[model samples]
Target: MYERLDKLRAEVERCKRKVEDDRQRLKAAEQKLQEAENTQILADVGALNLSPEQLADFLKLVANGQVGSAGTVSTVTAVNKETEVETKDDDDYDLEGLEDEEN
Candidate 1:
């Protein structure tokens, strides 16, 4: 009888360990799936030509359930501002000085 009780206890322990391992595997699989989904989303967003700031706003809208029927006005405005700044920066460089230095 004691031997039978010991065997049953060992079986119960084994079952518990197996359940825990399966739970761990399930958790890992879920994490992997989430990472893959995020990667796909990033790729799709890149294809849309959104800047980093626009992308952040887009993600925020999606997360807040406010993405429906939103226009591209904000993103376009942000990109335009960035372009203006970049153009101004390029204009600030002294091209004549660069030519003189090379000569």
Candidate 2:
């Protein structure tokens, strides 16, 4: 009986660890999905003016904390300027309103 009890306890602990690991994996997946969605939204809004190479370089610098406040500000300003230039004189499609009307 004691041996059976010990085996059951070990199984329960193993199940608990599995549950925790699954939870962590789910959280990581959700974070990745959010990042992908944000990237898509930026692309749709014509706000992502940086090329893949530029984006990779910027992300590396930011991740390493090598980008100080001034650097951060300048990067943001440059992106905004590019986006403005790209979107200048563009008419709003108002897709949201069109969807609402269709509904």
The model with the greatest TM-score is 1
What are the runs in model 1 whose C-alpha is more than 4 Å off? 57-103
lDDT (C-alpha) at residue 90 in model 1: 42
Question: How would you encode candidate 2's per-residue C-alpha lDDT over 1-103 as one tens digit per residue?
Answer: 5999999999999999999999999999999999999999778545655766556655666677655554223222124323421121113334687779989
- Which clashing pairs does model 2 show? none
In candidate 1, list every pair of residues with a backbone clash: none
Tens-digit lDDT track of model 1 for 67-92: 43433222122233454211123445
lDDT of 1 at 61: 63
Residue runs of model 2 more than 4 Å from their true location after superposition: 47-103
**Candidate 2 residue-wise lDDT at 49:** 56
For model 1, what is the error of residue 103's alpha carbon versus the real structure, in angstroms, after optimal superposition?
75
Please give the lDDT score for candidate 1: 0.68
Shift of residue 26 alpha carbon in model 2, Å: 0.4
